[model samples]
Target: MTPEALSGETLRLADAVAADLEGVERLGVAYSGGVDSATLLALAVRALGPERVVALLGVSPSLAARERTIAHRVADLIGAEVVEIRTHEGEREEYRRNDVDRCFYCKDELFTRIDDEVARELGLDAVAYGENADDAQRPDRPGAEAATQHRVLRPLARIGMVKPQVRDVARVLSLPVADKPAAPCLASRIPHGQEVTPEKLAQIEQLEAALIDAGFSDCRVRHHGDIARLELPADELPRAVAPGIREQLQRAGKDAGFRHVALDLGGMQSGAFTLQILNARGSL
Candidate 1:
């Protein structure tokens, strides 16, 4: 859509977000440095001044150092001050188990810490997270449950905004991460039922960073103990499997401690594994 058409169609969304923040002197935004949260941060700052907005990023083994660095840059671009707080989600046995409900425990801990500590110390009136309408269609998202339990605001979902609209709004606001690909937690690289450990998370991060350094921007390196399953866009899979490039791919995976490197020719898909589990359980 053209910028004008995009704005006209989504103007009500912005209005609803502003209305949601009404009566709140200050807002603490749960930021992950992704496009969704970055757009929310920009909107919060636009409706309220930079001084009224605080970007709260919960950091730990799950969050990548690259993402944290980019988050700081995005916050600076938005002129919103960011606070990086170390979260102990890894210490939670439920999270360490890496079950289907892993996200619930992880987010529960982060939101609990922010609500009990960050909000109290910062004198924030309300806490909000970036959950768009597209995310609402997914039954596997456990983070939303934590948000509901904490009574956190989901203005984007409330306003019926989806991923595309959020990106458009970010572009209109001149945010740097308008079109950035989704980057979920590093722990997500581990399949369900696998124990989540700092070492596994670090290996995943290292492998993903190596892939990006080698020119695969949007990809996922799923960890399966000694096996590394690489997921890239369908158009980019050839580059990973091509004659000489395949060797480089193996080196990258091996350097990250993977005994075998395999390619998922079906390509990179978000929530692919989660969808399978949800479908089998008749939950989706």
Candidate 2:
């Protein structure tokens, strides 16, 4: 919807986010070019001005190349300066273990880097990430704990803006990624308890890029040892299994080093394997 089409409630929520950043001299946003973060960045730029806001992107193998490119494009669209930081989450053994809290270690590394380097050099008074209200209440988001520990502000969650509200604000701001699907780190493709390695992440990225090339943009290639468990949205499942498309997907999986390719009938799910592990361990 256009900016003029935004409802009063949505506009009020957007104003609340800007109001939350009132006293900060300079702000650093943990941006990933997704709808939530993009909306936050756009609003922050509007409130604090583009010169006062910096988009900090943590570059690592976990981040897909395509995603990184999109992130830069989005930041440029918002007229905010982009800073790329190297995160060593992979060097942390706890992160490499790939537990349910893997995101915690990754986020911890990113925030730590920002605190040690970016904050001081860039004169940033505060940091924020795009955690919406829905994510604030979710059990799957251990990364929120890291954000809390780092004293990073969550304007969207603080303003009680959920995913739909965030998307609405994004559309109102004319952000390019307003309707983009959520794309988690490549490491999430591995089942919980499986060790996260650069190889696995690269393989998952390769197959996913191939899937996008084959016309399935929103999909997941869960790395299950020798098998690549494909997860596509329900509506795309039929197309995936079609004769020509099925063979294309199979070849893509094999080219990515999978011995067998399997399509999950349950469809694409966010944090699917992690939730299953959490359930089995009675942590849910």
Candidate 3:
């Protein structure tokens, strides 16, 4: 669909969201600063006003500092009260195990904490998050289960909004994150079954930052033991493999603590490692 078509849908969805928040005295939103959550926060602020809207950001070791900065900026733009709550997902054994469903435990801790602490402390009527309709079809997203368990209200999903629609709303509201790529957690760079460590997360973050500084915007630094697999956009693959640039990337990866660095010629695919495992198991 065209951007205009998406924008029209978002306008309708925003109206629906405003209608949904009409009776809520105080609304608490689980904000991540992505287009989805940003759009939701903007609409919520319009409906309930800044005084009644609170944006709750769950701070954790896995969360990138850049993402937190964006979250704060978005809250500031909307004049919403932003609450930074520390989440202990890394301390949880289930999350540390790094299973495919690791996000479940992390999100469970996050939502539970927000529901009990942030909501109660702030006297919020409802706890809401930005889970759009498109996410319903993604089987790999375990966080959705946690949202359901914690009874977190999903206004975007309830109103039938999707990723494109969220971006559309964000554009209409002039949110900076309207076109930002999805940035999951730093721990996602590690393969499932691998224990997540502070050092490994740091390494991935440093490598990714380096790649971005080198002009590779959409990229992933997948950690596998001492090997760093760089995934760049298909169009950027040639540039990444160029002799001089490849040498520079190799040196940067080494500096980031990787013994060997290799670019994935298969291109940049979201959940590439997961897809590989699934394909190996005949599940794809």
Q: Give the lDDT of residue 64 in candidate 3.
A: 81
Q: What is the C-alpha lDDT of each candidate?
A: 0.88, 0.92, 0.85
Tens-digit per-residue lDDT, 1-284, candidate 2: 23355558766876797799999999999999999999999888878888899999999999999999999999998899999999999999999999999999999999999999889999999999999999998889999999999999999999899998888778777899999999999999999889999999999999999999999869999999999999999988999989999999889899999999999999989988778888988987
How close is each model in CA RMSD to the real structure? 2.5, 1.8, 3.3
Candidate numbers, best lDDT first, in rank order: 2, 1, 3
How many clashes (backbone N, Cα, C below 3 Å) per candidate?
0, 0, 0
Candidate ranking under TM-score, highest first, comes to: 2, 1, 3
Compared with the true structure, model 2 gives a TM-score of: 0.96
lDDT of 3: 0.85
Residue 76's lDDT within candidate 2 is: 94
TM-scores, all models, native as reference: 0.95, 0.96, 0.92
Kindly report which residue stretches of model 3 are placed more than 4 angstroms away from their true locations once superposed: 1-8, 275-284
- For model 3, state the Cα shift of residue 277 in Å: 4.6
Task: Tell me which residue pairs clash in candidate 3.
Answer: none
**Candidate 2 lDDT score relative to the true structure:** 0.92
Q: Model 1, residue 89: what's the lDDT?
A: 96
Task: Give a tens-digit lDDT track for model 1, residues 1-284.
Answer: 22244356456666677788888899999998898898888778877888999999999989988999999999998899999888999999999998888899998998999977788899898999999999977888998999999999988988889999999888877777888989999888888888999999999999899888888868899999899999998999889978888999899999999999999988988987677887888987
